[model samples]
Target chain A: MKRIALLGMPNTGKSTLFNRISGASARVGNWPGITVDLMSAKILMGGHIAELIDLPGIYDLHGFSDDEQVVRHFLANNALDLVIILLNSAQIDRQLSLVLQIKKLNLPCVLALNMSDEAKRAGITIDAHSLEQALQMPVIEISAKYGDGLPKALQAASNILNQVQQKPSPNTIRQLLEEDNQIEHEMERLIQQHVQIPTSLSNNATDTLDKILLHKWLGLPLFFLAMFLLFQFIFTAGKPLQDGLAWALDWLRTDVLEIAFASTPAWFHGLMLDGIYNGIATVAAFVPIIVLFFLVMAIVEDSGYLSRAAFLMDALMAKMGLDGRGFVMMLMGFGCNVPALMGTRVMRSRAMRLLTMLVIPFSLCSARLQVFIFMIAALFTAQQAPLILFGLYLISFITMFMTALLFQRQYKSVEPFILELPPYRLPTAKQILLRGWLEVKHFLNRATKFIVIGVVLVWLMTNFPSNVAPASAGTYAGQVGLLFAPILDPIGINQELAIALIFGFVAKEIVVGALAVIYGMQGDALMAQMATQIDWVQAISFMLFTLIYTPCLSTIATLNSESKSSAFMWLSIAWSLGLAWLVSFVFYQSARMLGF
Target chain B: MQLLSQLESGQSGIILAIEAEESLFHRLSALGFRVGKPLSLIRRANFNGPLHVRLGSTDIVLRIADAMRIQVNTR
Candidate 1:
């Protein structure tokens, strides 16, 4: 198969173009390194199955950044049929430098002037024919977002692949670096001759929006407002959808499944309904919340306000020895810590990535947030619920910041923060829906397998020693809970809660599911039962514990892979567990002392 | 002549030279901060934070310390 690598400066719409051409739903954020790892997809082009490799966006081939090194190393070590160098047509002058540098590799390449729609809208014109004449390569104008001119670009690339011989060489990097300024000069000359910018073309819209959004006084408050509304939407708007799903799942298990499995053995019925249905349904109920979250997040990110958020937060983030971009990753941690951990690949420094990874688990991921929301609804009044939830989010940020501050000194070197603020563009409905669907798909794919296995394990632990009543002291789960009862007693957690926490270690979404199974209640009945078992003070303590506890099994697996150090993984677990215990203990004790 | 950081918001300048250490220099230059490039300080974040500067069609935010290392001549 012909291998073609997509290369471009960060945020030049390369990943979007890749998705458009290959029909792969790779993440397309308005920020850099969204395609952190090299992503390849097989696309049928010109009646040929071509493998397209999407490289991480790079600013310079000779630059020392991690992404730059990945691009350089791949180009040097791998034999490529052709390279498609994407350039943001709106910023062709500065982006042209990279094009010149890539051309120095003497590889068979095509120049894709991406974002031509934006350029045309902004009244910036590029003479592609003249550029092709000067650069001695095919130049194609394309809009990756709308899938315009993609077939022609792919055909052009296929044509180049056939015409050029594969000259695999590792010496390209040294040659490119040795002739650095020459490339810059050539780029300057090309821009002077081929690209024309009208002085009347102004970015007044972006400028006007930024003035208000990035204003010193209004920036932070507006950001908080946006987040508050997002959570508000998740709870208020998502409730009916969540209830509908839960109702349907309950009807399936109780009304339909019980009738169908009426003659089955008691044990089989319990395993299928109590174990699998309850566990999967409990996690699945939150899918609406997750979908809504990703929808709002995709909109925010696509609007390019995410970078402005980073810009606004940079001053505060720097105090903790993290860059503004790390703050963006931490925010992403709210959706799912695994991808957020992977998102740390965008960080330029190893120390920065590690530091960000340590703090990400504290970001109150959707799983933990669902648990907290459940607790708040069960234990608190309607008016007090949002406030309590907001307070928990506040605590999450504080915990992450303090953790970064405490561990910042351990990593001696910190990368200086440098970020590009892309212009704010309204995300198309298609892009927003695609991004949300991708996230929900990811959550469901991971949740079904992890939650089912976790639920089955918990059911086994509670039901074994067959002579004993289910979930009673004679069961393995009850015995383990009792063993830890002494340590947990101070935090006011009962044996059932303790057992649920143990299951939660497998996946946080299973906490509520385990409780539902152990207590033999579902939906509102479970909420009522939980209300009777735990007081508001104890409930608050439990929420704190859940908020601070160790990362779920999947997050730990991601941390292990991304950090690639068992010691660091263990350190993270220990830090989170110790902090959770201490915080919950103090909260419970203090509430008692204050006569709550 | 002044440091890039000293240029107030809306002030335009031509980069004369970057006076940072080797790695920082290369990183800055890679982002089009080379000598003779025209840039303007779009805004300086509050609390002595990073400066938002525009070079050609790219808008970049860099720390105050990094801005100080880039020597520029006022337009």
Candidate 2:
């Protein structure tokens, strides 16, 4: 099987092409690393088993952005036999620059001129033959959306690897055009013969849609409308499934527990039924919402609207010392902080990326989202759950913005910003589901391994001091709790809550799992633990700390890889920990001062 | 020049410069909002403040002051 690496800037239809060839969304995201996440997919191209390594979206080989470096290093290593560069023909100039750079690498490459349907619709036409002749390489024109020219493109790629004969020289043009003016002249000539840019592609459908969707007065309304629909889709899609699963989990916990452990000792019964099954059930409860969220996010991402979102958010983003590109990383942070931090590689300046990485820990990932919702449901009513959950998100976002401002004042490095703005296209449903499932799978893997281990460890810590009778304070668990109690005192978290929260910090959903294991909560496991052990003020403090706390281990590793330095890696870890400590301290102290 | 929200869609204009009173001048320019680029107003945000405008195929959202500073002549 030949290995082909698909390369392109974000939103140039690489994912679209990959999806068409492989019958997969390949992964979620049209922008940057969201789709491939720096991994290769095993694909069969042309009835032959071939591995497709979908590299992250990168603008150039010259830059040092994290994913760029990943691609640069990968390409330079010459690990693959074929390279397919997808370009948006409509934005030919900007995308062509990348092609020009990729061409200079002197690799076996195929350039797929994508989005030709839109280009034609916009009155633009590309001469694929001219582009091919100009570069002395094969150029395939395809529209990944309309499924036009995909077979030809893939076949070209396969043929090039198989039956096609390469010229003896393969024609490496080092001084290809001789001068900048000559190069421009040649490019202009090629476009003049083969490409035509439309004067206007305006249509009443889009114009009418834009009137309401892109309305100045109504734009924001529409933006919120889009956002609300996304959230509604997530909630409505998952709520019933979540309820049925919860009912099944309840049966597993009680009826199944009684039958399975009827002959076991009390301690063993508690360990197997409450500790193990409880952890499993806790993870299962939120699985629906997490999967649903990822699905909607994948849809938004694959639709190419996420890039426009970055554009729409540039003003607010710039205010916080980030460019539109930084928002790309932030959106990734919504899935998990680790990738978001890793996504910061797109940021040019080390300082900006570092600062953004520091604050990203504040954004709630899907893992933590379930914890907040569970607590809200348990403490208040179910109706209040959504509002409080929404408030927490707002608080995290505002805090992240303010924190960015503060960090920028303390550092002075400028990031050279160049971005690719992709036109909106509907993402395929198959792709969204596939990408969302990968995320769901990753979360489940964590839940099974680290989360389960974390719960048991916390349970062991809190259960060891069973001195008085039914696990009293003299046990090892109580002793450890007493030991950590003072360390947590100033921060407003009790030792037990702190232990649980720390375990949760590994992956936020595990907090409930740990608490359930510790306190033996039923039904609404997370909320039950929070209410029984943590007061309202402490709960709020815990949530704030959770928002500002150290990123999960996966994020830590990703940050380390991005920074490529132990020092910078630890700096983020230390900064987030210190910030979480301070934020929680203030919340706890201020609340006490105000007689809460 | 009016804020981006005030401009009709598809209208083209040139950015004279950024008029931000705050510290957004350099940031905006770094993001390619420098003077002399032909910018088109796309959409505006809440209260005609933050505006979505395009420069060189890259759409950017900027505040009213940033938009106002980039003097534009409607075509």
Candidate 3:
């Protein structure tokens, strides 16, 4: 199959075009680096199946950023039949330089003057015929957002694919690299001749909106209020759906599974019902809340509020040696650390990317947040619950910044932070749902495999040595928990809690499941049992320990791949474990000394 | 002529030159912040934060320290 590469500067509507053509729901945010990884999908072009590769956006082919390098390496290594060089019609003067550079590569290419509709609304006009004449390539005006003039663009690319035969000579590329200034000058001349700009393009809406959203005093307050509302929405809106699912699971376990396996051996029933079903059901109950979170996050991100939040937090983040974009990724880490860690690909500097990755595990993702909510509801009164949860989030942010400060000296190279603030547009329902669906798919993909393996492992440790009582001190899990009891004893963690922490290494949500099994109760019964067993102070210490402990199995796997250094992976584990233990010990000891 | 950081909000200027490290120079230039380009200071974040400037149709936020290195001629 023939391959076509999509190339353009950041926020040029490249990914939107790719999504419309390929029918793949790659994230379409109004910010840069949303498509950090290359995405390819097979599409029928002129009745022929062709694979379209969507590369990360770049400003110049010779730029030294990570995204630029990814594009440069891909073009150098991949065999492509045609290149679709997209240019934002509104910013043609600045965007044309990249087109000129691509032309010097001697590859057959088509110029897509994208966002023509927006340009027309701004009272700018472009002569496509004149641009074609100057560039000696087919030029088509397109609006990827509204799906206008895309067929012509695709037809032009298909025609070019059939005609281009040979790669550009290395000597030609070298020559063009040496004459970069001349190329920019030529691009400026071409834009001057073919594009006409209006004298005054009104931006009253955006200006007014920025005044309030980016206000000196109101910015931080508004940001926190927005976040707090989002958190409240997730819980309030998701409670009914979560309760229904839990009820259904309970009925299935007691009514359906019990009757179906009535004649099976006792051990088999125990393994099936007490071990697998209960464990999985506990994790599944939190799925509704997680789904709602990503939905709200997608809406906020698509609406362009996240960039404002980043802008507002830049000064505070810089104190910890991070830029606003890094802070945005940390906010995303609150939802899930895996995607947030991947989002670090947007950072231009390698040192900054690594530094951001180190602190993300401290963000207290939803999985860990689930454990906190469960423990809080189990131990605290209704009014105190919100304050405790809020405290945990505050500590999470403080720990992340503190961790970054501790390692700031090692990463000395701070690249100049330059981010483009795209004009806000209302996100379409289809786009918003697509982002939510993609996030749900990612969560399930990671959750299913690891949750199943983790739950079954815990089950085996508790149920093995078939003669002993289930989850008793003589069982394998109980023995392991007993071994760690002395070390955790000072912090009020008993054998059962220690075992739950062991299972938590797989996924934090499993900690709740492990507790349910150890106590031999479910739902309100389990909460009641927990209340009787652990006091509020000990519960808070336990929550703190869980919040700051090592990243879950899936996160560690991603950290290894993104960081690409086993040494850093090990360092992350050692640091998080040591910190969690020290903090919990201090909290527990001090509270007891103060007569709590 | 003065540093861009010295310009108050809503003031326009022409970029005279940029004096910074090599990587920062390339980054700023690539973002259409070259010499002779007209730009305006939109706002400065509170507490000595980044300077939000508008260059052509694009709004960029950069550190105050980096903005201090960009020489501009206010008209």
Candidate 4:
């Protein structure tokens, strides 16, 4: 199969074209000896099965960004059949330089001008035929978002791959270095000859919108309002769907599976129903919220508001040794830390990315929110529940910034903050749904293994040896909890709650479920037991611990994969764990001493 | 010549020089910030954060620190 790679600058619609051609079979490819994963898929291009690799979007090939290095490294290692360089037709003047750099590699190439429709609307015109003749390559104008002229683009790529091989250019690096001085002149000449642009094209729409949206006084509040509405929408819309899913899973276990397992031993039944089924079902029920969250996030991202958000938040983030993009990633962490950690790829500097990773786990993600909500409702009154929950959120932010403040000196970012603000476009429904679906699929594929392993391990530790009642003091899990009892005593966490903490380490959503199993009850019964078992202060300490402790197993896996540094990931885990203990201890002791 | 960061919102300028590290200069140039190129300050974010500068037809958000490295003469 021929290997074709798609390369482009960021926001060039390269991903849209890749998805347009490859459809849903696209999977991430792990290049040999490289930690980076590139998205690639095998597709039948004009009756020839070819592997298409979507390389990371880069500004310049010689630049030192992680993405640029990944692209350069991929090029150095792989002998590609063809490289399809995609340029945004609306901004081809500066983007064309990438084509020149790729051409220096002496590889077979096809040039695709994406967003042709947008370019045309902006009163820009390109003589594709003249540009094709000038560049001596197949140049096609395509609207990747609308499926316009895509067949011709694919056919051109296929034709180039089938043509006879060109001899490798001798002294390619030296030749490229010599031509680098003249690259700008060549780009200008090509544009001068084949492209036309009105001197004062009408683009007041963006200006008017920015004036209001980025208003000095309103930008910050508007940003907060947007985030507030996003969560309100996610919860109000997602809760019913989630509760419905939970109900179905419960019915499946009790009504159908319970009868089927009745003839089996009690231990086996418990392992299947409570251990595997319950564990997996709890996570599965969260799928709707994740999907909705990403769907909204897709709109926020593709609509171009996210960049403005970064612009508004950059000053504050700069003080924390980060850029505005890091702040956006932190907010994303509130939905789920795994994706937010994965999203650290936006930061080009390693120091900034690592620092962002360190701060994300303290986001009080929806999983921990579930545990906190349960605890607050069980221990506090209706009036105080909201206040206490708000307090937890406040603590989450304080701790997150404190972590950044503490570590900014260790991980100082020297890279300049330079991000493009793409003109606002109405995001198409097709692209939004595709993005939402793909992210959800990615989440399940990467997170399922660790979650399953974590849940089953918790089950085994609580139910093993077939002697002691499940989750009792005689069990192994109880003994592990006992080992930490003394250290946890000062924080108001007993051995039983310590076991819940161990379960919470796997995933915070499981903490309440673990409490149910430990006390041998569920729903109101469990809440009643919780209220009698622990005071409001202990409940508050528990919530604090849950809020600040290590992120879920899946987030740890993502941190390790995304950062590609086990030491960094381990350090993040240790830091969060230590912080959680200290914070809980201080809060618990102070509240008691203050006569609360 | 004045720093690009010092330019008033809606003011246009010609790039004179970029006194940044090689990588950052290259990045700025790749985004169409070359000597003799014309750019305009679209807006300044609150608290002197980033300046939204328009180069050719592209809009870019860059920090004041980065903007300060570029010398520009207002038109």
Which candidate wins on TM-score?
A: 4
Give stretches of model 3 more than 4 Å off.
A1-202, A241-292, A328-354, A364-393, A410-414, A445-447, A506-513, A521-537, A551-570, A591-596
Worst 10 residues of 2 chain A by lDDT: A168-177
Evaluate every candidate with DockQ and list the scores: 0.55, 0.16, 0.62, 0.67
Better of 2 and 4 by DockQ: 4
- Model 2, A25: alpha-carbon shift in Å? 55
Candidate 4, residues A1-596: lDDT per residue as tens digits? Answer: 88888999999988998998889989987985357888999999867889999998999987758897677667766667888999999888779989988876777889999988888986589999999988888999988899989889888987877777863433453455446536755776797788743233235687788888899899999988998898788778988998899889989988999999999998888788877886678558657866877777777777788899999999899898978878887987887787677667767899999999999999989889999888887888899989998999999999999999999999998777889887776776776787768877876776676667777887888887678887877788899888888899999999889888888877787788888888999998899988999998899998899899996877876777778889998999999999999999999999999997
Colliding pairs, model 1: none
Model 2 ranges off by over 4 Å = A1-211, A240-291, A324-357, A364-395, A409-418, A437-456, A463-472, A475-477, A506-573, A590-596, B1-75
Question: What's the TM-score of every candidate structure?
Answer: 0.61, 0.50, 0.62, 0.68
DockQ leader: 4
**Candidate 3 lDDT, A23-79, residue by residue in tens:** 853433222223345678887776677888888899988776888767766666566
Kindly report, for each predicted structure in the order presented, the TM-score of its chain A compared with the true chain A.
0.56, 0.51, 0.57, 0.63
For every candidate structure, what is the RMSD over all alpha carbons to the true structure, in angstroms? 18.2, 18.5, 17.8, 18.2
Better of 1 and 4 by TM-score: 4
Residue A254 of candidate 3: its Cα lDDT? 79
CA lDDT of each candidate?
0.80, 0.66, 0.80, 0.84
